[model samples]
Target: MNEALTLISFGENGWGDEIAKGVIVTVTLALATLPFGLILGFIIALAKKSQEPSLRMAANIYTTIFRGLPELLTLFLVYFGVQIGLQQLLKLMGFDVYIEVNSFVAGMVALALVFSSYASEAFLSAFRGIPQGQYEGGYALGLSHAKTMRLIVLPQLIRLALPALGNLWLILLKETSLVSVIGLSDLVRQSGIAARVTKEPFLFFGIACLIYLVLAIISSSGLSSIERWSKRGDATR
Candidate 1:
């Protein structure tokens, strides 16, 4: 037990510092992806609900394709295919530059696409849960459509969507591990390296698992608080 502890201890003979850096990368990637994913998902939800048939069809197609594909495949496409495409485009433009997509950027894009696809469905459900009367009420108040949605509809939509979105956030957090396959040096990758070098796979991997569990627990607690706060007005009513 002493030997195991020392192996992970924070010093020259241990893997602690490297593992800590990996955790940071994992978290930073998730944070970087969140807003883009949520905003894009919200936009996709709007598109899915648009009166224009083409817009609705396009949104549906997008969600279907992304949600249907395996996430690893999506990452590969983004990491490699996107890089190739960009290189080709640049060459065509006479720039002749080689383009290599950063693993972090590629991971963020792929995960955002996947997250947004699922989030759009959740947002759509929330939109449906809202009453038509709200829109009518806003119109009656002489508010413009956009203003009504922004001022009145959005708050309720978020309240309704929060639980599902929270669940998605947890899933997104786990999915960050997938980026390690693309050489992102995230938590899982660092643990793998430590395990290999120290010849203690179970110990390092077990530590990695515990860290992930802690993150999930913390995320759940925070999300629950946000959910309750969002519904505070409803509670008063």
Candidate 2:
């Protein structure tokens, strides 16, 4: 037990600092991805709910393509394929420069796309649950379409979609591990490196698992609070 403790101690003899940094990266990546994912998802949901057939078709195609692709494959395409395409484009423009995609950027973009795809469905469902009278009520007060959505529709939309979005957030948190595949040095990669160097796979992996469980537990608690807060004045229980 002493040896194990020393192995993970926060010094030259241990990998505790590296693991800590990895946790930071994982958390930071998730935080950075959330707003973009949520906003894009909300936009996509609105597009799908639009009366225009072209807008609806485009939104549906976007969600279907991203949702159908495996996360890792999407990451690979963003990191490798996009980079190559950019490089080629630059070459065609006579700028002969190599454009390397940042792993963090690639991972965030891929994960955000995936998260938004799923989130749009949740938002769409929430939109459907809302009555048409909600829109009429907003307009009855002389609110513009955008203002009506921003002030009235949005609050209710968020309240209804909070639970589903919370679940997606948890999934997104776990999926941050997938970024390690592209050399992001996230929790999973850090743990993997420590395991190999120390020849204590179970120990390091177990620690990783514990860290993830703690995150999930904390997230669940926070999400529950948010859900309760959103439902606070509801007459429909």
Candidate 3:
């Protein structure tokens, strides 16, 4: 209908612009969370592999706690808890300046925590999958520790981890929707607004669903390419 078209039309009279912006925000947040989560997860994996029992125990506890908590609950706790704690600390210091936590920052931190928890397990498994003979061979070749890791260990580890990491990326993309719950103007939030204003929930929500499907398809295609590339060395052998 012309009416439905108009509701999604570009310009001040419609929500097309808002929806576009929301899509961008959602993508940006997911991308931002990716590196931080991977780095933290890498650290946790190493910690668990460490000889120090204390370090291993600490890493285990961290993984258990974050992995056990629901993502939404973690978001709420990080967002509101940090905000309240910061305000209280500022009051105690007599600064009196009001500080508000940015929803984007909170979302990034919370999601990163959740992402790392899951990713660490994948990384740890990849680490363990490397054969002991590889390390011995590297040392026999007179390679230093760093060089051995870079030359012999990393490539195989990445190949092993890529599939799981790609899957996690897909999950993270969907999880970005949860950020909308905390007032981030992500795609779902924008669509909800449009639906409420236009009184056409089905139209707007259906549009949102299609958009997400397109994104997932695109992501899956890219992941497939990466997986193929990772396996190229094996394929040749």
Look at candidate 2 and tell me the lDDT of residue 90.
88
| CA-lDDT, candidates in order | 0.96, 0.95, 0.93
Q: List ranges where model 3 is wrong by over 4 Å.
A: none
Candidate 2, residues 1-237, lDDT tens digits: the string is: 999999889989999999999999999999999999999999999999999999999999999999999999999999999899998998999999878899999999999999999999999999998999999999999999999999988989999999999999999999999999999999999999999999999999999999999999999999999889988878883
In terms of lDDT, the best-performing candidate is 1
Candidate 1 C-alpha lDDT tens digits along 1-237: 999989999989999999999999999999999999999999999999999999999999999999999999999999999989988988888998877889999999999999999999999999999999999999999999999999999999999999999999999999999999999999999999999999999999999999999999999999989988998887452
Which residue pairs collide in model 1, if any?
Answer: none
Query: In candidate 3, which residue pairs get closer than 3 Å at backbone N, Cα or C atoms, i.e. clash?
Result: none
lDDT, candidate 3, 106-159, per-residue tens:
999999999999999999999999999999999999999889989999899888
Using lDDT, rank the candidates from best to worst: 1, 2, 3
On TM-score, who's better, 1 or 3? 1
Candidate 3 local Cα displacement, residue 154, angstroms: 1.4
| TM-score of candidate 3 to 2 decimals | 0.96
- TM-score of each prediction: 0.97, 0.97, 0.96
